[model samples]
Target: MSYLLTAPEMVATAATDLDGIAAALYAANAAAAGPTTGLLAAAEDEVSRAIATLFGAFGQEYQAVVTHAAEFHTEFTQALAAAANAYAQAEATTCSALNTFETQLQALLAPLLPNAGAGAINPPSITSIGAQVAFIMGGTGIPDPDPMYVTGAQTLFIQPRFPGFLSDALHTPEQFWPTTPNLGNLTFGRSVAEGVATLSNALTTQFSTLGNSAVVYGYSQSAVIATIEIRHLMAQVTPPSPSDLGFVLTGNPNNPNGGVLQRFTGLYVPVLDVLFNGATPPDSPYPTVIYTNQYDGTGNFPQYPLNLLADLNAVIGIVDGTHFYVGLPPDQVANAVHLPTSPGYTGNTDYFLGLTQKLPLTSLIRPIPYVGTPLAELVQPDLRVLVDLGYSDYGPGLSYADIPTPASFLSVPNPFAVSYYLAKGAAQGVQASLVNLGWLPPSYIPTGYPYAPSVAPGLNFFVGQPSVTGLSLLTGALGTAARDLGWIPPWWD
Candidate 1:
């Protein structure tokens, strides 16, 4: 079941939490500069690490400063949370003020939002493409009347979490399968297989009434499931019943181990053949788009440490030509008229660094909320105020079914995804889609940083002329995937 939190509820939770974090910061500063100082310094280091991680292969001097600022914010919040009533209340008041200030700031930019209009990519048919474990639902929302989109489509968008997200979301991004107790408990492939299995079973009966619907393998993660599951399903002779089959892989990963730590190359060959071997019509046979980001760390063959993975992601794909195509090239960087001719020469590192510096640290690090407060509010309540409504006891086995979907996840108010994609230099069509769908700023144009067009107001990340074209490939692949799924125009031979 999905639930929506009011704007006030969201603000209140954040105000309360920020109040706590502010107090923590003050305490950390005032308290003994020994242990507290150590913690503060560690946080600073962590922030630096996070910043460096964002750069991929490039690092900058400001990145350290940004890290320090983030750490300070974290320490402040932690200290504030631990403070007594006097400090906590004061901190809360300060947070309230900040919230008010933030509100006014947003009000100023409210006009930039897309004007309400009919959405894009409406599905025309419900082509059923059943899989054994789960039916993959693409991540990006598809508009109605789009051939691929079935009104109440049931699909899964599952993939391994990026490294940064591990620290950002799961708390331990480094812990691979069999490493961390909670995460490692289940086999990586097994979990995906299970999700597919359950989806297939439930969707079979659900789609019966929905019409001749199909399963869409969307996004890198969804594509991962589709590729792996297809390989597994192909092993069986009579692979269950199905309405219709299609694998609309957008920005699809050619290999299971293509992400961080894992780097298997040429793994997507079979899956590519399965979808686009000229066996099916232009739209049929599951269109797959191997999206490659020219600026993506993976674009540089030697940059990604693919050998680190124990078994998966063992092989490496070529970047320019020899590579097993994964994403788009650095079109964003290539368009830059004035390239950063810094001391070092070559590659997209210079461009990426330039862009990284543009995003301010203050925007990236979200303030921490109060202590003893609900976990939902303590971590970024503004994104979506999710006050725990008596749903905690279910410890380890917390599935999507256990919790309600927030308005933000289902209907994200902000276009963080679009902004990020734009920064990466996505295709004009995809950018247009984002703008048309009210996903991003309408006037936002893809240009080489420093010279290319204007930057969006209120964007925290600094934008130097990006030297990478990763965004181009990434957007192109995603666009291709969207087309395959009947969200955009079909791909031509």
Candidate 2:
């Protein structure tokens, strides 16, 4: 057999379309019937019908639940295959070019070997271990749909950033980063509270499997989880390794759950620490890089477009004016961890990774200003060191631009916004998402989590009807009272 030096491992979790069957049954008239006339037959009909109805409903729900998950998984598999092929072609061409260039260079100079010309050669054999991987997590809200697309784009984008060391153009993400199928336990779309444990477990699994250091990257909500988990999920636990690096790019929880008032009060950091099993994150050798976006004041002066919308919604009682807060600077905008949606004014992008300043019309006029998502400022010092990607982050090749924020109304069709972002992702010519919407577009941008309503009647609904959709605390907590703490679910087990 031809010895295989390296290959990308295609990872996949089967798309399970859970089986279901529906049946309608009725017994023949007991007096006239032969098979159906008996008591057993009557029982069978009733049981069959009941079971069919429930099972059918269960099947539909399961299908609905897995719909996004399965679609993204397929996209991921296909994208990886395409990326792997692209990488292979590029690598072959590059190697051939390098070989030709090296041959000519050797003729001009001396041969460069494992050792530089003159030292005494000893039995210094070099043993090699496999490559290290860097798994980047995406922002949240609608889960399951985002991760894979993020990964696909990430696979191509991450390669160029590490020119100093790794240069495996043909490598796949499984070989380069995350080495496995899970993004923490982010497979099923669940709220962050419930979602964190899965991510924690995923990290534990990767570290256990690799036994070598790796990079962990998290953006937005993913940043929060990665930051909290750095100490615990690191490869060597107590004895940290320099090889491990956790990049918590952006995810700033500026105000507790943003401006939305919760039914019950909960401390943001404290709750995190509790779930993480300590008052503070433990110190580790792995370093973390944090990239924050600055506040944009453009939406405030003439009045942000969202304010106008919020005003209209308030007049009709769609949203209460008391609870809805706007007109704050970008940093103060409680967007939790995402870029402010529908930025009315063109804010500055000085904080973006690789954007250049435009020259002014004249000396009197100032250079065009820039800004980024205000969430990047948040960082946790307890766990790891922070490397802030300031107004601009420059590597060897490309610049990360604060591509203009799209201004649109709620009425703006999603496809319109989607096409724009996708084009941007493609045009930027990088493996990054269009302004970090993750791999896939958000399924839905929830206005708020907990979604607690200050209205008492809403609170009554929450407490009285736990199963109510849209209005329940699980789905929507439209209440002023803390009848339900609405604690986030499925903390790391």
Candidate 3:
């Protein structure tokens, strides 16, 4: 029972008289200049000269005004067309929803009715009414597709690294970020670098097969992998357009590469900004999230390779004459990166000041550069953009979770999870999916659902179990963690 509203019919037709008015005005002016055969005797002779000046000025202005009007008309027409298209799409979605609800309501009510007579809310008539919401079939023109397109709904979820004992030797840059599409070996499991490169290759294939763009999510070492994946895509001659990509980053190591963020807009939570002295650049469509929570002790672990000297970051900060991870006050939660978090160094004030308050003095071992650039600089720009986006009050929800004691930092995962949900919350598109799936709870859920488990379908972390020399271990724990966090598939022996 829908009816269309029509515009009021009482308006005057002034637009129709514009041409007639112009013609009359022109004729009147032209007639005034006719038959100037005899010159005026004295001062009156200047009338024709004055008329010529007035008409000349008016004609020049008139031409300019006409050009401006045409430009305005073009802009307005385009705007109108865009508005009409949006209206049509919205109307169709709403109508379909209403019809479905109506059909369901009728089915329920029909049974309750004691008298199912022809005049008593007939279901058949309602079905016919629903059928009337059909497409108009008379248009002949086909419009060109828009140049900037964000087509299809798909997500690319990247994962962070797990806690493990490793070394600076594991920073195999060549294997992690290969220049060619022919991905190198698969058995380089000593570092997250190899894992990331393998994952990148698989993701490219998966994205292509889906025929859709993706929303990449990453944290810690995995954050590095996420950017690398984008790099891989851009290297192609016909790279995927930026509109097709989106990011949901948290605790990333470096400032996100502007090359990608400028194109694909998304949420960036630099929960780990201290590593690169808070580098959040301003080149994103959305505001970045600056998160620092009490329980994230990982920041305290001097982002130098896991097995490299623990206090190496502090040494560099001291040598550089300023804190490398500068800009945080002692009271803040993110300042934990500046504070030493190991059990031995927890209560030691001297250790907090970058000295050997409770160590074997083993930090003298400084590792050589593998990837490129000084280590800190490499990690700086990647996460700096996150800081810059949040530099003003550190973006929305820009406060710390204040852990009661520094002792509970590593054990409690809640602080990190809090910021993780915040990142997802900022991505409205991802949030919509959660609302539809009913997985999001009022209370916090410890496990994160791997939106797409097979994102890196056949990624190999290390070639294989030591028993098998160079064979690809199709089933690996790291890849499983990358895919699904809510409930990971069991690891193979």
Candidate 4:
């Protein structure tokens, strides 16, 4: 039997390159159309007229052939793109089916198997009688000895770690460090290091002694600890399988695109005992889910600091308790948006963005009485557009929404889109404000979870509205403005 190996990513890239080639060809053909197809006799002579007519005919025939070729090229590109999508979907479906089958098979064989299942004929002598277990770790400020914090008794938010599997299962708390700040209780590094060590030992023991699978739940500071442990496990000669071990990190500062730690990777604050330890491993062997709240300063920092408005919004988010995921209702957490990963991403990691219903700007102003809410509603729509520019619309591990990212100085903003949003936002803001103030009836019934205004609007519009024209105009405008103000440098490009 013969087999064929296919890489969907390569196929997709080829299709993209072909499309570019077709576009260039089309542009070149159009430019030559008038000169090549329009016949103009050189001296009004018969021979000159004949020559021009013959060449014009040839040019027309060539154009007809080019059109057919362009059509075929477009169809081929579409087919290739579809093939890539199909292949990706097939792989995902297969993995899901296999996982489900494995779980079902384990459950069915539990009573008959000898020490092979949670309730097997000859089960291991352990406190918990389960094929899988969950470990919970608390964030900073929670005391180490507090049973509620340790055993996840009071952390109702993290109880739904793995919805179907681990919700009702045994939850073992791995609390071996001081959960307080460095200056107050223990040094931050020492505290996190201790948690990492404890969790590592616990996981190793569970795998060896109980011969069971396990999932860990980490929140805030403890999420950082989990990140460190994942790195350690990844470096091992034989790491744990995705099925055997999994991780759930909420408000993780080690998030690659937006985590505060990753935002200032090389920076360290001595007095605060905080080190920008960098991001969590994106290509870990264990199944991991990172949950980041939209504007949380710790988990989702701005990618472009030049946008001061975005920076202020993030700071407000921090003050508004956007980082606190411990008390959020289970349904709200479950409803978080699943972020998109890079194409052909084979790593065992998933990212989620928890959308903040109220704009951080609105939240900041909503403290005042009657006018506060209405006033904020009036300005939020337009202001959101400006803030959205501070982030990249499409990238690995990003949601197709108004999400934030770490600092990226090289990125340029689309000035036309900026202008469009400003106009659209102003209109929306006026309408919303009027509704809030009872001037106009509500256009849409408020669903308690109000949808924040997004640049992309939905998942289908992932590319948003950016164009070459917009970029060129923006660059030109910037240059012209700078020149007029006598601020243009000779080295400026």
For candidate 1, lDDT tens digit of each residue in 1-493? Answer: 5522122222333446676665675565445333322322224577876654555323333444545765777666555444434444553564466445534554554454221121122122223433222233432121111323321122111121001000000011111145335544433333334445544554455446533334443343344445454544455575423334334343333321122212222111221221211110112223222222221222211112222321111121222222222222334323322211222112111111111211111122323343212222122212111111101111111111101111110111224322332333323334433443555553432233211222121222111112122432443454456456654311111
Candidate 1 residue spans exceeding 4 A from truth? 1-184, 199-211, 217-222, 233-243, 248-252, 255-263, 266-284, 288-493
lDDT of 3 by residue, 204-292 (tens): 65346434443343333444444455455556786544433444333333332111121112212121111111222212222122122
Q: Tell me each candidate's TM-score.
A: 0.25, 0.27, 0.21, 0.58
Off by over 4 Å in 4: 1-131, 144-183, 329-331, 395-406, 444-451, 455-493
lDDT of each: 0.29, 0.28, 0.27, 0.61
The candidates, ranked best first by TM-score, are 4, 2, 1, 3
The sequence of per-residue lDDT tens digits that candidate 4 reaches over residues 1-493 is: 5533243444566678788988987888888888889979887889999999999999999988888888888888899889978865764564466445544554575454322211111111122344666676667654343454434422443344443334222222333234333435555665676677788888887788544777777777788889888988888987766667778787888787778776656444443456666678876767677888887877877766667888888888876878777666656677876666544555666777887767787786887899998888878766777676666543322232112233554444545345444554565566567778987555421221112643232111122212122333444455455456655322111
Candidate number achieving the greatest TM-score relative to the actual structure: 4
Model 1 TM: 0.25
**Candidate 3, overall lDDT?**
0.27
Best by lDDT: 4
